[model samples]
Target: MTKVKVENLTKIFGKKQQQQVALQMVKEKKSKTDIVKETGATVGVYDVNFDVKEGEIFVIMGLSGSGKSTLIRLINRIIEPTSGDIYIDGQDIAKLDKEELREVRRHKMSMVFQNFGLFPHRTILENTEYGLEIRGVEKEERQQRAEKALENSGLLTFKDQYPDQLSGGMQQRVGLARALANDPEILLMDEAFSALDPLIRREMQDELIELQDKVKKTIIFITHDLNEALRIGDRIALMKDGQIMQIGTGEEILTNPANDYVREFVEDVDRSKVLTAQNIMVPAITTNLDIDGPNVALQRMRSEEVSMLVAVNKKRELLGTITADAAAEARKNKQTLHDVLDKNIITVEKDMLISDIFPLIYDSPTPLAVVDNEDNDRLLGVVIRGSVIEALAETTDENEVMDNE
Candidate 1:
């Protein structure tokens, strides 16, 4: 479901008359520079249209002055749009009156800012419950909720401490905890991690990714860093000069840029960081362990022209792997394939980054099995060493290589 949608969203910063003139200029397809020069109005976000799906991290990214921050503010009507519709669950938030918008902000949306917004005087728990406190939730109940949120972020022990006592990263966690305490439907994270040190930023990024597995809120994250966007965004909208340059997955944008600007914007990204095992894995050649005996497994390896086969049950749950030597030994001994199955085969989660898969694939004697760790270790695909190298080199299709060994 689309949790939030923006259609032709435009925000102009100027006097009323200037804004009106700029709006007309925009309707005339006037360029951002032309509109500014003609009407003395700055177009903050230009005709932006995008929908954020439910339970996704939709990142809006660009360099400074790219209007990414302005675009995010427009979504919640913080900076009122000059013209356009901001729909949250189909309700036109841009059209909502002050009190109506307040209710929506209070109940549905919570924003975490670049600065760790916390009170110096208040305890972490007190700061966290601040949102619920304003909503007139019972004190005891709000405290409980706040504590749980803090606990989820692994900061419950520090709940009694003031914000000043916590490190920058810990303070940010408190900020995140405070946002979650409200149980909002949408999280607007505007450069939330940029203020942190590099190492801390990455840790927070990993924590956010991990937290999303549990909360699954519609997250509209704004960032200036392309790497940060690719690492966390389910899909990314790359913006420039208050206009969107392109919107796509990291791989799509990297491999097939929409324009020259986007191409240059992502030209230097490390492909290994953007590509995951699932992006390069081929369909796994398998032998059904429950049904395929040693001879049947051998025949599959012969026909497939491979030395091994991934073993799986009827349900396609990964069992192990069987090498030609192991298969042949089982055949000579008149034993089932399972009797000689190599259950020690290395398996990688489908979402593992190619960078992380490199050492494991090259160092291993067999291709790594890509399994869905969340799905009972169900076999998804296989990632061979050649596939990993070819993916980094950008010379082969993701699912093109099926030469499993």
Candidate 2:
């Protein structure tokens, strides 16, 4: 189910008199520069539309002035849109009254900002319970909730300490704990980790991933870093010039860019780190254990023009692998294929990164088998050396073209 849906959401900034003119100029396909020159109005966001699913980390990413921040603000109605609709849980928030909007912010969604936003005077526990206090929750109940959130965030030990005493990452965790204390259904994080040092930023990213596995809250994360987005987002929306260039999973954005702009944005990314065995593997050729003999295996390899063939039982469970040379020798000896099976076949899970498989591929003579983690290690496909090279080479060529352009 869609938790949030935005339709034709547009935000224009300037004098009220010029807002309509700026919107008209946008409708006429005028450039932002021309629109600003003619109407003295800036378009913060333009005709944006997308949905956040029930429990997904939907990242909105772009460079400075991309209006990603504005889009987030619009979702919670922190900034009113000049024109459009913002729907949450099938209700149009744009049409909500002041009291209803307040309830939505108080109970349904919580935001985390880049600044950490922890109060200097308040203890970590006090800061975390602030939201519940504002809602007039009982002191004991709120305290319990806040402590639980702090524990989940690994900040319970420092609950009595002030924000000044903690590191930047810990302060951010306090802000996250505060958000979670309300048990909000959706999380709006705007550059929440961008202010931290690189090492700390990575730690926080891992923490969020681990937290999400347990909490499964619907998260709308905003960031300027492509690598961070690729690491954390289930799906990402690439924005530019107050518009979205593309929206897709990390692998899709890297492997199949929507246009020149997106291609350029991801051209510099490390493909070996993002591309996985599932992305490069081709279907494996195989012979059956129930009926196929050594001659059948050799014949299959020759017809497929491959050096090796995988062996599977009646249930498609991977038994092992057999090479044409081994199969031919076994046929001459009149032995069953299982007698000469190469049980020690190299295999990698579907999600294993190409970088992690480089050494394994180098040491193995035959293509590495890609197997499903469940289903009794069923053979899914084969990852040949050429396939890995080709995947990397294609991205390199694309990047070089982008550099040339």
Q: What are the root-mean-square deviations of the candidates from the true structure over C-alphas?
A: 5.1, 2.4
- Point to the candidate with the largest lDDT: 2
Query: Highest TM-score: which candidate?
Result: 2
**lDDT scores in order:** 0.91, 0.92
lDDT measured at residue 297 in model 2 versus the true structure, 0 to 100: 83
| Global lDDT of model 2 | 0.92
Can you write out model 2's per-residue Cα lDDT over 89-111, one digit (the tens) per residue?
99999999999999999999999
Q: Can you give the lDDT of residue 228 in candidate 1?
A: 96
User: Candidate 1 on 1-405: residue-level lDDT in tens?
Assistant: 999989998888999999888878877878878988888898899889999899999999999888999999998888888888989999998888999999999999999999997999999999999999999999999999999999989999998899999999999999999999999999999999999999999999999999999889999999999999999999999998788999998888987899999987986677788778988999989999989998898899999999989999998999999999999999999999889988988999977889899989878988899998888999999998898998776633332332231
- In model 2, the worst 10-residue window by lDDT is 390-399
Worst 10 residues of 1 by lDDT: 396-405
Q: Mind sharing the TM-score for model 1?
A: 0.88
Extract clashing residue pairs from model 2: none
**Colliding residue pairs in candidate 1:** none
TM agreement with the true structure for every prediction: 0.88, 0.92
